[model samples]
Target: MSELIIGVLGLQGAVSEHIKQIEATHCKGIIVKKPEQLHDIDGLILPGGESTTMRKLIDRYGFLEPLKQFSLQQKPIFGTCAGMVLVAKDLTDSDDVHLKLMDVRVKRNAFGRQKESFEATLQIKGFESPYTAVFIRAPYIETAGDQVAVLATYENKIVAAKQDHILVSAFHPELTSDTRFMKLFVDMVKKSKEIAAY
Candidate 1:
């Protein structure tokens, strides 16, 4: 087994799906339900779900401050759907206590509600061909800073992006059978380990 350890924030959302992807990559995928759990992780994943409910859980579990600090440290993290919103610098389009990691502004429910969920073949940056993206009430990064690079786009909108070790996907890449995104994340974990050793 690989030494890379990934933490999937299990506060709420599609934790199982992300776990499946992480496991498929031959790395350890741990469900992080507590603030202490964040300490041992080499990388972290914030899954998709109701943003409001996720906030409540983060606050109720007293993880509000710790998670925020963790992201600020530039640890390798990938956020999907609502998770993307939380990790962003701010979501002026919506009202919520976001983790505020990336310098992107997210517009919540950009495609409507649950019924607005969709599937589209996206042209991801590093990927060779188009990827089947599953978006469930996803958000769109309205304003990305210069450091942020667009990883994937759908219908001329930025759906997937990365900034240093932090990645955010408006669509749920975990829901798809393709493991490219997860592989990229695993690669990121390895790179993070190498850099930390220096």
Candidate 2:
């Protein structure tokens, strides 16, 4: 009967936009920089930001192991853009892997450089219509594990995917005005709670 409280990893990036999206969903969104805060959140979001810098901060703040544990606990997690790269298990041509939670192989800046940033209407699974996806120096999934479900694709490239409690997008959903992806994350949180209750 308690209200849902979602946390956004506040190491860097568009944290406020995600908080606003969570607020619009009628759930609380808090910035979590410390590991202790994870205990209070029903779901967590890793927002779009510089992957390398965020990784360093996460290590400095001692959030790496805790976040890996959070993902292992089956709590809902939504990763956007660089966030997606952070969560991916495999990073092509790089030895640095952060959370390594989702079973996916990602290519950093898969869409070329910053000038190649573009937008597209993505036909995401479980959604009735397409979503306006904003790709900014995005990292797309080159390959995924058997457990990962492809959600949205752009030009035959994997742009979105889900595996168990983890959801990820190569594009920035928060950048767009639409809140469907945020809603889906909230709904995932509710469903996870319901399952836990049973």
Candidate 3:
């Protein structure tokens, strides 16, 4: 209804970069720091950050309830890195608690620590350019349920996946100038609109 208000959950890392990338698509982006900020958004972009810390903020701000409610609305959501972890269906083995929105399991810092952070040119499915993905203390998606569709892979592991209207990328697509993945997500928003119009 409202003109495409996409929110970036801003409690932790890479918040600004998500906002910048979302703006590039010409969609109005809002910073969602509290539960009250979740209203009226057409979609949400959860940025790469410390999953543990972000979880604490969600609990502290009393946003866990409203945020989950918003997500269940089936509004398009694009989550990267820690965002991917947050959206996962389960974090049973991990120490960090997550919102568990996506039906997958992710291990935090599965690649390496800060010093092990590296960049790779990924051949993402359904994209033109070989996307330059930045993985900084990133999480690795271990298992994707049947509902999850693998979008990209690295080292024979599932790195990007989409389940229903939710898209999750294990690497930081926002850190780079590459807008391909971001554009893909924006397209999801447009698709959501089209589906609703019918």
TM-score rank order: 2, 1, 3
Q: Write the per-residue lDDT of candidate 3 for residues 19-103, one digit (tens) a residue.
A: 8988988888888887777776778888887887888887888988887887787778888887888888777466555677888
Clashes of each: 0, 0, 1
lDDT of 1 by residue, 1-198 (tens): 248889998988889988889999988899999899888998999899988889889889998898877766667899889889888887867666477778898888887765487898888888899899898887898889999999887767789999998988998889989999989988988988887787
Q: Which candidate has the highest lDDT of all? A: 2
Off by over 4 Å in 2: none
* Candidate 2 residue lDDT tens string, 1-198: 589999999999999999998998899999998999999999999999999999999989999989988877899999999899899899996988888899999999888775468888889999998789888988889999999999989889999999999999998878888999999889999999888788
lDDT of 3: 0.82
TM-score, every prediction: 0.94, 0.96, 0.92
For all candidates in order, the CA lDDT equals: 0.86, 0.91, 0.82
Task: Give the backbone clash total of model 2.
Answer: 0
Q: Alpha-carbon error at 168 in model 3, in Å?
A: 0.9
Which regions in candidate 1 have their CA more than 4 angstroms from the true location?
A: 95-97, 113-115
Off by over 4 Å in 3: none
